[model samples]
Target: KTPVATLALAAETLENKHIVEKPDKLATYAGIVKYQSDHLSKQIEKLLRFAHTESGRLHLAKTTVDMHELIRESITHLMPLIQQKNATLQLNLNAAKSCMLADRDYMIIMITNLIENAIKYSKEPVIIITTINTPEHFILSITDNGIGIEKRHIKKLFRKFYRIRNNEEYVAKGFGIGLTIVRKIVSAHTGKIYVESVPAKGSTFTVELPGLK
Candidate 1:
């Protein structure tokens, strides 16, 4: 169902007197409303981002931002979803050089989108977020034990509205612009993104940006 239909159905469900009388049922329906509201809001935000990117209105406010700190903040922002999905994020942020020149807001969005993808697409969401600061670049990787992408789909994942659909076991959702926005943000930062995956195994998305050493 579309988000509007889901929201309407959830709202209608909340009107049932029996559900209202039961606290657990009431909470569940209410949660559906909140979740759908958030989902719709995120979709709208993505649309605005897409418009800005297409119109060349997307601009970056660069500053000395710490990649480690941004990663932590992104995790905190996504804590509710993590708990809801029973997901665990193991962090290995041993990057001696963590600072970079980038837009902090866009960085958070990029990080959050990757981490959220890891959680949403995986049956067992044990995501590992690792960071490495090489002499020339800062690498951030989000690895998940999810329904990995096929080699054929790897090249098209960054295209707007493109999603992996070969797996019947796991049906991924959303407007499919998440990765496109992520790629745009990375490009704006003069970074490169890569993915390594094996079908039915897992996938790792790595973003390499210039580090401020």
Candidate 2:
């Protein structure tokens, strides 16, 4: 049977068996179902986005976007996770007044993934996000005091489904598709991603794109 059919049957079975009869049990089961549903939704969205990007169907509204404001907005959306981890979120947005010609949605997705990943693997409780404008390029950097990746894993980080096999101590909740999506989005905007890391020292991700006057 198809995956959706299988899931439907499982849900029906769970309901019919009355395994969630107690109020608390039912609530717990509901939470699990919701979490799975949300996870599936994100995966589907990512796949659709990837398909559109590959087919060149993704729409881009090339307008001037304030880099500093965009970064602050993205961090605000991720504030709960940062707070939950007791991690400090610092924004050294020197380029806040600088504008870039790009799609707002794509930039948001790129920044969101970078910040989220920083919060996820970080053990140092601090994250620094900064934006800089070079003579020819705009640079967005997210640095975290996380578990830090090894050199070998750096090359594969952008590959679809690629994940580092760290011990459970460093494992985060994900299907390992976020970076792949981020890479695609960055490339769609004619940008490149760079990484610098030392195991246990943390990692830094820098996105470089052509700057607009």
Candidate 3:
């Protein structure tokens, strides 16, 4: 989303120039400024979290959480984008709801990033969010029918500031920071993330966290 950030900053600069001659443009300029401001805010939050994690200042307040409920809450927050894309989002959660001990804020960030990535990459009409219960982990998967990443790019998907090359259509607007934050947040929670993708077939990101009673 760095590209978006740059665009926003440029817009702000332009807006300042037009303040005297074209005050009417302030509304449009304000919108762009706010968009960039919010994106930067998220990045700052991630940076703070990473700093805490590295310094061992990050502490988990373990509590039993209903996975399905958490997923639903995430979907609700992302519903606007899903609707804007004219894409359908389906939740196929298991009948069983597992309770896990973890920090609630971190879990929200993890799930939000996954859903955001799915929506950003999808080109298809529908997206699926599902969960599976295993003896050792609670598996959550976000699958999208969008332009999938190539096999070669899969390895670097989690690297900070690493983004896929040659997809100008997708690269034009994003700074490629979402997945990095996602990986860090998952790792902080003592979980793992996996990805499967085909250039045209789409991609699935699965996250596994300890499922405790």
Q: Write the residue-wise lDDT of candidate 3 on 127-152 in tens digits.
A: 78888888788999888887888888
> In model 2, how many backbone clashes occur?
1
* lDDT value for model 1: 0.90
In order, candidate lDDTs are 0.90, 0.79, 0.74
- Over 4 Å off in model 1, which ranges? none
lDDT of 2 at 32: 51
TM-score of each: 0.94, 0.78, 0.77
Question: What residue runs in model 3 are displaced by over 4 Å at the alpha carbon?
Answer: 1-37, 54-57, 172-174
The top-ranked prediction according to TM-score is: 1
Give the per-residue lDDT of model 1 (tens digit) for 1-213: 777899999888888898899999998888878877887888899888888898884599999999999999999988867887899889999898999999999999999999999998998799999999889999999999999999999999999999888645666568899999999999988899999999888999999999885
Candidate 1 at 4: error in angstroms?
2.6
Kindly indicate the candidate among 1 and 2 with the higher TM-score: 1
In model 3, the number of clashes is 5
Q: What lDDT tens digits, residue by residue, belong to model 2 across residues 23-73?
A: 766665565555456546655877778777767655778888877778888
- Cα RMSD of predicted structure 3: 4.0
Best by lDDT: 1
